[model samples]
Target: MEIRNAKETIRQGAPSDESSKPDHTTKMIVYMTIASTAAEGLTGICSVVSSFLNDFSME
Candidate 1:
């Protein structure tokens, strides 16, 4: 009975320690996604501005 309790306690403790660890891969993925989104937004804005200026200059 005591051995079972000890095993249960150890198992619970193990998960808490594992959960506390920062997953670098997940962080990297999130960072990459944010960077890609920002880059796409900037590119889209630049394209719009360039087209607007071209149209204005032609008018």
Candidate 2:
């Protein structure tokens, strides 16, 4: 019957929705971590470059 099939489909899809939530959360966390690390590396490089330039200019 149509009603019985609808219930079966809903049951089948429940686990899939639950599984996707964790996957999205993990992906977001990984992206944020990578972004922060890249920012730190860039900041360090800029600081070094600025200091080097200042030293060179003084000479």
The candidate maximizing TM-score is 1
Off by over 4 Å in 1: 6-12, 15-21
Q: Per-residue CA lDDT of candidate 2, range 1-59, in tens?
A: 99999899998885665676645777899999999999999999999999999999999
Q: What is the lDDT of residue 11 in candidate 1?
A: 80
- TM-score: model 1 vs. ground truth: 0.65
Give lDDT per model, in order.
0.92, 0.90
Clashing pairs in 2: none
Scored by Cα lDDT, where does model 2 land?
0.90
lDDT of 1 at 34: 99
Candidate 2 residue 53 Cα shift, in angstroms, is 0.7
lDDT of 1 by residue, 1-59 (tens): 99999899998885676789877998899999999999999999999999999999997
